[model samples]
Target: MMHKFLMSVYKEMLLLKRDFGGLVILFIMPLVLIITITLIQDSTFKSIHETKIPVLLVDNDNGQISETVKQNLNESGSFEIVTQIDGKTINEEVAREAVFKGKFQLAIVIPEKLSKDLQLKVNQNVEKILGSFGMEDTASVAQKNIKILPKEVKLYFDPATQLTFKNAVKSAIDKMISKIETQSIYATFQDQLGENDAPLFDQKSFISFKEIVPKVNDKEIMPNSVQHNVPAWALFAIFFVVVPLSINIVKEKSQGTLIRLITNPVPYAVVILGKTATYLIICMIQFFLMVAVGVYLFPYFGLPTLDVNGKLILMSIVALFSGLAAIGFGILLGTIAKTQEQSAPFGATSVVILAAIGGVWVPVFAMPKVMQYVSHVSPMNWGLNAFYDVLLRNGGIGEILPEIILLLLFFLLTTAIAIVYDKKKREV
Candidate 1:
């Protein structure tokens, strides 16, 4: 059984080696894509990292908290704050256009009622605290006297903007808002109590920070370029396996190899398993080779080192599901496709479409809300998320369990469909 499986794998490998175009498409093409895109994105991320992103700040409030938040943002050095465009203060439509046109990375709008909202929140918190201490009527009066509506600082950015750029701006904004909020709480106490007396509320006590690091030291962390493209192009290449596998299956059936197999002493399941084993091995090779390029060759091109966070076990599980899902899809496509002409276009088109919607070409967050929801249906999205859990998130097996289960289900569904169709074909 083992010998037969080995033979099947050897045969596929030989065919793959001989098919120069297939070899290039499945392996070389994705590698080139990874290198090219990573290099391009690396420069952009590096620029953003090295220099502050340009952000348009539309401070409509002109109040205490808004001014403090603006001051904090300016002092943070994460942004080159643009208060004016072409000798005029930022206009909402113009700022949005600037962001859309790539003139600014982000636009932040501080609403006119920010100070009032913060004061209201403080008053409500005081009322709730007093109510807890059996002063219900006094608390009710305080709450009724101060009508505080909810408010949020509106952040504007282009839907097509890169994830890192958007995240940096958000992080900076969050910090600024936090500082203003802390001050607001302090100011509320100052108003209630005399300014000379210390405020009872400890803002630091209300907020805390925690850092999550991989098992490895901080210096060994993987770069964003490696973090993204490795799994992305690797999964893409693995799925592209469907094209050649489908073509081979169609060719084999046409040439009587499949017919000859059924007549042989070998069981049908072994033949199917052999083909699956062959493609699984091919997928593993493609993944490892890409990892090798990302780890070793990428540094030469100014990409970050992928000092793996000792999550090879987690990554291996992801790779297993990824390979299974690809092979299962290939088998299903093979079972349904009658000819190379049919399989080739269908397989290639499906992979490309899946990749586009799956956050392989672009981050899912950058996509429109509808597209983001639609992306969940793609197996590539699940695979990419599993990879992210291990690679970027420094997650354990438990963290990626959901994605693993989903990918497994995808594999089972596609393989079941293929098996059902095959059984029907045989019965007919």
Candidate 2:
């Protein structure tokens, strides 16, 4: 039985080899696509990394603090602040519209009386702190308790934009606010300290908290473009096996070869198993070859080479699961498709739709909430997520357990349905 299965597998390979042109195209097209896309996206990411995020600043306050905020943003080298154009002032609504229209990634509207409001906020904080510390009777307490109205700056941003840009803008704004408030506090403290000359309060021993982000190792970071494209194109190419696989199955069925095999002494399951094994081998070859191009050929194009972090075992597992899912999907399509015309459209269209929904064309996070929820059912999403977990997140096999299980379940479910359909057809 095992010998017959092996022979059947070899037969599948021999038949595939006969269509050498299509097979060669299948292997070459994904490599070409990955390289081309990586090169194209390289320039975009490079521009973002080399240049500052373009932001529009609407300074209605035109005050010292607002000017200082604008100066700080420009000096920080993270943003190119556009305040006005052609001697025309930009308003808050225009800034908001610019962000919404993608003219700018961020828009900041400095409200009127920003400096005064900020100064008032500082005084209120000092008064509250003094009261909490039981220093309400202090001579400076009455003067500090004078509260000023607070106003908020309106910030406009597209929620769908990348979070990194938004966070950078937010962090810069936070630092600007901190600086303004600290300066205010310092001025108030000097006035109060000079008057009170409190001997009980040890100014020299004052402790303050500081925030710092921990440093990451240089080798730990992978370029986002490389990480995304490598797995994305690989997933696309592997699933594309559906076309040829389904076509072969349809050809055999229409030619009466499958029926003849069913009438022969061999168990029908073994022949299907052999064909699946053949396609699985093809899937692995496709994966490794694409990875080789990424690791070897990409550096010549000024892109980062593929780095697997020595997780070959986890990588292999993902590839295996992806292959199984693809083969199962192909089998299901084959069982349903009665002719070449039916198989071609169904197989090709399904793969395209699945890839689009599964985030091959766009990141799932960037998709609409409904589509993102719907992406969960796509096997390609599971495979891509598993790849990203390892390549981008530096995760191990255990981290992708859920994805792995889902992929395996997808394979089993689809293959079972196809087998049931095959059995019913044979009985008829």
Candidate 3:
């Protein structure tokens, strides 16, 4: 079996030696991509905020009424208005044009009546909170206290705008509201009852600093980029790398080379294993190159530095295996695809979509709840999270065991499927 496996690896190596494309796929390309992505993410195109709401302000109430409304919103610090359109630009022409241009996420035309509306909403919401209608109406609530009604803030988002971006902004707003609400409640209590016998609420801390290596805040910043990014990217970068290489496999089969190999005294299992082994080696190299470059060069692009220690080493190994899983998955895809021309689009599309969901292209925290849950099935998310746990979370090897186990499972499953597929194909 060892002899057979060695021969299989040798055959794949020979093919690669002749083509020389494997080096680029496994090492050079992944490194280049890692650098590029790191640069884009770390660049100071804008300040990172807890939640930056791209709101448009149309201050129609130019007098103290509008100013008071603006002061309240600003004091909450829940949003970052991208454009502050003049009160004079409150016309339908300006509003429609701005909306079409996508200058802001939500538009707020502070109608001259905004102050009155807010006071009314506040009074209504507070009244609802107090529950003081009539004696008969309070019969059901006689035993239990009523829940605090959430402050009803109106949103004026353009429905035609990009849904994903819009949702992201909305989430920010929600987070901001949740954060400020505790304070708002406390302040209201203080105003109503003073420090005497009123309900005491601890003020929530604002996220003025992120936990980074420099120890910018109370929480420790993540130690390295590898833990933070590698797991997400292992599958992401390899998915891209696999498309071209896997398509080559389909090309070989279509050109009759695979069929010819089947008759070369080599077991079909051996042949398939050799191809997969080759891809694995290539992927391993890709993983190393991307990580090495990312550790040293990432800071140049404004990305946080990767920590180098036991944690870093372990993350690299686990992430590399994930890349191998991706390669095996690609091989399995190639074997099933039947034709190169037909395979290319499907393979590429699958990788891209999986990568996006896997948190390769974006932080999982940035994704919606549904996507976050859905991505759990993909190897990319596991790998990315493992890296994060190992590096950033300062997790030991034991902590990352689950991710490594998952990668091993993926490899075993894909390899088994590839072997079975090859056997069936040869039988035909």
Q: Which candidate achieves the best TM-score against the true structure? A: 2
Q: Which pairs clash in model 1?
A: none
Clashing pairs in 2: none
- How do the residues 201-308 of candidate 3 rate in per-residue lDDT, one tens digit apiece? 657575576543634357556344344454455556666656766777787788887777767666766776676677766666666666666677766765766665
C-alpha TM-score for every candidate: 0.64, 0.71, 0.65
Pairs that clash in candidate 3? 26-286, 211-221, 212-221, 224-307, 225-306, 227-387, 227-388, 231-383, 231-384, 232-384
What is the TM-score (0 to 1) of candidate 1? 0.64
**Where does model 1 exceed 4 Å of error?**
1-6, 47-223
RMSD of each: 7.6, 5.7, 8.0
* Candidate achieving higher TM-score, 2 or 3: 2
- Candidate lDDT values, in order: 0.80, 0.83, 0.64
Q: Give the residue spans of candidate 2 off by over 4 A.
A: 1-7, 14-21, 36-49, 58-63, 83-103, 106-113, 120-175, 182-186, 192-223, 260-266, 349-378, 385-413
Candidate 3's TM-score reads 0.65
lDDT of 3 at 40: 55
Tell me the lDDT of model 2 at 350: 94
Compared with the true structure, what per-residue lDDT tens digits does model 1 show for residues 245-363?
A: 88888887788887776676555566667778888887888888888898899999878876564866678789888988988888889889988899989999999999999999988
Q: State each candidate's clash count.
A: 0, 0, 10
How does residue 158 of candidate 1 score in lDDT? 78
Which number leads on lDDT? 2
Candidates sorted by TM-score, best first:
2, 3, 1
